[model samples]
Target: MNTQIQRNYEAAKQIYANLGIDTEKAIVKLKDIKISMHCWQGDDVRGFLNKDQDLTGGISVTGNYPGAARTPEELRQDLEKAYSLIPGKHKLNLHAIYADTDEKIDLDEIEPRHYEKWVQWAKKQGLGLDFNPTCFSHPKSDDGFTLSHPNKEIRDFWIEHCKRARKVGEYFGKETGQPCVTNVWIPDGFKDQPVDRLGPRERLQASLDEVFKEEINPAYNLDAIESKLFGIGSESYVVGSHEFYMGYGLTRNKLICLDAGHFHPTEVVSNKLSALSLFSEGMLLHVSRPVRWDSDHVVTMDDETLAIARELVVHNLISKTHIGLDFFDASINRVAAWVIGTRNMLKALLRAMLEPTESLKEAELRGDYTTRLALMEELKSYPFGAVWDYYCESSNVPVREDWLKEVKDYETNVLLKRD
Candidate 1:
């Protein structure tokens, strides 16, 4: 460890100790929190299906940066590089389209054997795996509908695909000894206003019921459904709007996935955590940054991101929340994007864990609003960087901006060589 970093951490430890916070314990807790890193970021949301299909649905990757992963091996290698730079042992979130097989198999025909290599890889690396049923970017879903499609055949196809995805999630969980969260998100809506709104929602609910009919062991798999306010093509109405899924999740007793970029520009996901945790068994978070729309930009250490971490720590909701990154930025080094986003997430959680929660709670409970607000503002200027630096150092990862050089070197040596 650097002498200066150690000195700074010592000083910060003293400062936090004065506030009744233990910086060492904070670091330990931060290490325990695992953020699920999405695999789509390395390949620009393009999966290795050995097909030439354009990205459809309401989603799109903006940039065409060089060296995007072309095969499953390359994507896994990039992810390995990324995981090395991140601090904790995190989970890898995979979509159904990323099945590691050369055989020509339809989505509905996919089986756990298709992902055996991924399971083995995760076991080798000691990483947990989460899953998503890919309901977009397919011929059957080109009309911006899947589970709620007007055609019964199309709806059944998606339902079967999701059923298979749950099996894969079960496989991951049983193999990794952790509950795999299998999330379902579909772009079923209209680009223009539709005459019949209730029809699609009713169909969606029925289809979901069919999909979840075969309940896997809760110890092996957890089901979650995601909602979106709007998407690029579905600007007029999204069938799976927040209101729709909130009702569905509550009624169906499933996890509700709240994507940071899936809401209105002004809406903050951090504020919703507490209220949702009240009734739900657990929740899933798709943490991303949206500039003006649902852009899926890489996450940063911004105010909203920090607030999310703060809320999770303050409310003690970390155990009930499954945090995951949900962004695909092909504009820059994909490995760097992963490292930056994951590290920033860890930093936010570390900052939250280091807060003087007891004092803050005491002030709030006693109706000492003035002291609470003042302390909240004062805590912002604390030496959070020092503790974070110490964390990276002790965790055997790069400290501060030093990880950027390693990513640059990787781009030169490995990524740029790819045709």
Candidate 2:
């Protein structure tokens, strides 16, 4: 243990103990909460199969960062480097397009065998895996319509892809001993206003129904539906709005995936977690940062990020909430982006766990808003960082900004060496 880190943690632990917050227990609880890292960040969302395809469906990776993982082996190597820096074991979220098979196959023809390599790697790393159907950035989605396409043929095509994607998720869960969340998010709407808004939504509803018609074991694979307010092409009307998924998920017994960047600037995913927890058995979260719209900026330890983590801990929704990172910033070191975002998320959870929620709730219960407000405000300046540094040191990972050195070295020796 780092002597300085241990000394500071001791002082901080006493302070938290006074507030009836067990710092050790907080660390223990945080150890169990794992954030699934998005694989798209490694290759800027340009999956191995469709290297030539330009991303569509409002998805864009802006920077021309060199050394983007060009193959499954490279991506996994990058992920392994990233995981080494970030403390604790975590899951890897994969898209259908990242299939690691020598056999050339389209998204609709995807199967569990295609992702066998990913599962094998996950098993070796002791990490779980999550899956998503690649509904965007493909020829089938060139018109920015999938699942809700007017052509029944296209809808069926996507539906079959999603169905297969679920099987892949099931394979992952069964293999990893952790449940897999197969989230469905499609860009199916018009750029301009259409008179037939109801028609597209109805079609989307039917498409999702068809996709999820086969009931997979919930223990192995849990289905989730993610919605967006609007996107580049679908600025006027997005077929799968928040309400659409909320209704469909509740009635159909599917998980609702509330993304941080998928809503209006005024709306926050943290506020929705508590409400959604009431009706659903579990919910999936795509934690991201939005500059103005759904920009998918790399997550920082911002107010919203902290709030989102706080909701999970405070509302006791940690067990029911499936947390996953959803940002991709190619301008910076891709591996560093994963480390920074994931560390921030864990730090937020640590801070949230350190909070004296029971005492605050008691104050609120008695209408003693002054103590509640004061305590919350004061905790913002607490020695949470000391505890975090100690946690990092204890976890055998770098403390504070020390992890940056490893990333910088990796960039020089490995990432930059790639063509």
Write down the TM-score of every candidate: 0.98, 0.99
Worst 10 residues of 1 by lDDT: 44-53
Q: Global lDDT of each model?
A: 0.92, 0.92
Off by over 4 Å in 2: none
Pairs of colliding residues, candidate 1: none
lDDT of 2: 0.92
CA deviation > 4 Å runs, candidate 1: none
Q: Each model's RMSD to truth, in Å?
A: 1.0, 0.8
205-301 per-residue lDDT for model 2 (tens digits) = 8988889889899889999999999988889999999999999999998989999999988999999999899998689999999987788998999
Model 1 Cα lDDT, one tens digit per residue, 52-109 = 8789888889887888999889999999999999888999999999999978999999
Model 1 deviation from the true structure expressed as Cα RMSD, one decimal place: 1.0
